[model samples]
Target: MKRENLLVLLAGICTGLAALALTMLGNPANMGFCIACFERDIAGAVGLHSAAKVQYVRPEIIGLVLGSAVTALIAGEWKARSGSSPALRFVLGAFAMIGALAFLGCPLRMVIRLGGGDLNAVVGLIGFALGIFIGTRFVRRGFTLQRSYPARRTDGAVLPIIMLGLLVLFVAAPAIFRLSTEGPGSKHAPFFLALAIALVIGALAQRSRLCMVGGLRDTMMFGDAHLLWGFAAIFVTVLVGNLILHKFSLGFGAQPVAHSSHLWNLLGMTLCGWACVLLGGCPLRQLILAGEGNGDCAVTVLGMIVGAALAHNFALAGNPDSVNEAGELVVGGISMAGKIAVLLGLAVVLAVSVFNSRLGAKKNG
Candidate 1:
């Protein structure tokens, strides 16, 4: 294998292994490392949202930001930058999380879910690809977010430092810090072990710039499957690891913490996929970029946290038995989460059309 390919493969393996370790250590089923879910949990932990069921300080997420920061700084890639449609990126980030919660996973978790034999993730992946395909159409039509310029040093350091503070909180395990007594937030691996695994994965992801969105987008826009291969490795590694650990359960129904609503899964991930493409990376990529001093991505990350909070507060987030009960508004046996995805997808596409018109008017003027 080529050296670069080897690096990417190693990164994927690292992530897959970390996910397995987390699951074995007591993280929720098929939820070893989910950007959207973890952020929602963090939102709950910080009292941003009052969903008592999913509140915890996810150390892996904090580790991801800090590890990326450490790697970026060591590699001298930590130049602070911002101002590339920050507002729009923030909105897209929010929408991305909205859809992800509806589907109950991000792209990475989607892959891991598939590896664990959740056929529901298959539909989600299809929706993800469809969304990416549509977004690529916008790209072909000259959709642009302009450019990011240099910014202050503090702009880049803020999130990393905040993450470090979170790490301290995790260690302190203070009673006043609002942690989940039950649900996914309560399920976690050994604190230090999970943190160490997360740090390794985050460092590797930062170094390799691992992103499932970019991989799929590149494969679609070009014939390059190079990036896609790394993700494929992740899927296979996770699958094999799950099998060896007796964690692999094959079926569409009876999946842990998942709904059987296929259409909604497709729709939710569609929103996430389109927003990811528009923002130029997945949520994981945004975290890595934020770690590397991208203030715009940091703002985007902030948007995701807010989005998670809103999802929980509004009951927009889905769970295993919530398809017909207790989440968002259920209409005639259907949850409003799917409707939200459709509306969000439409709204974002409409925004793109408006941008296109403005650009055209400028050209004519």
Candidate 2:
């Protein structure tokens, strides 16, 4: 097998193992390594949310950055660079996290949720695909971020070291950042187990360049199938694992930290989907790409942090019982605003794509 193919295979396996560990450790089945949810929980740990039950610094996230950094360094893949519409990317990142939180998970989680038999994930998945399609249209136009410039080596290393620092903090202040007393944080696999799984996944993912955005982008842009194959592999692995563990459950009421509002599910993931497209990668892809020295990805990571902070501060996030003021859990589903935002966002993305494409055509002509 070619080296790239081997790496992709390893990536699929690692992702599967991570998902399985998440289920075994007591997260919702097939919910292992949800980039969005885990990050939101981390946001809560630093007091981003008043939701006490959800607060805790997840080791997997910290491990992902450091692990990817380690792999990139060993493989000579690290490169420090910047200047890809930094401000726009940052906004996209922030909104992406918001959308993901709204939906209760990222693209990775959407797929994994389906693996666990949550039909709600199907809505989210469709929304995500639609958003990516819209973003792809933008790409077909001349909508392009400016090229990045090389940065100082230390600048490249700084973010990864900070991630390492977080790992140490997890060790020194385990009690302070103690796994949640209840809720998702409360139900984690052992620290070392989580760390090991995260490290392996991070490394493999870095090598494979696995990304949810890329999955759709490739299919639309070039009719490529390799990245899609990796996604399929992960879905298959998680599905089988859920079956084997008997953790698969059908139906949607009273699931942990998930709401029944189908509109919000679609809207939330749509936000995440659009933002991921604009920023050029999903949250996990952002993390791995950042480790490989893509400063734009790092900016998106910062956007996620800020977005988390804002969500908690503004009461945008939903608890297990209910949503915020503007976010009502109506009888049929989520409120009208939720549905409108998805439409509006898509409209804006489409307009941008059309405008940019016309400009590009003129320039070429």
TM-score of each: 0.93, 0.88
Estimate, for each residue in 340-364, the C-alpha lDDT of model 2 and write its tens digit: 5445545654554566557666676
| Regions more than 4 Å wrong, model 2 | 1-3, 175-179, 319-365
The superposed Cα distance between candidate 2 and the true structure at residue 323, in angstroms, equals: 16
* Total residue pair clashes for candidate 2: 0
Lowest-sum lDDT 10-residue window in model 2? 329-338
- For each candidate, the alpha-carbon lDDT, in order, equals 0.83, 0.74
lDDT, candidate 1, equals: 0.83
- Global Cα lDDT for candidate 2: 0.74
lDDT digits (tens) for residues 1-365 of candidate 1 = 77777788889888988888799889999999999999998999899999888998888888899889999999989989998888888888888998888888899999999889888889999999988888877776666677799999998777888889888876776665678878788898887887888888889989888998989999899977777867898899999998998989887775766776788888888888988988888998899899899999999998999989988887787666433344452222125764665576558755864586467456556
Shift in Å, residue 110, candidate 2: 0.7
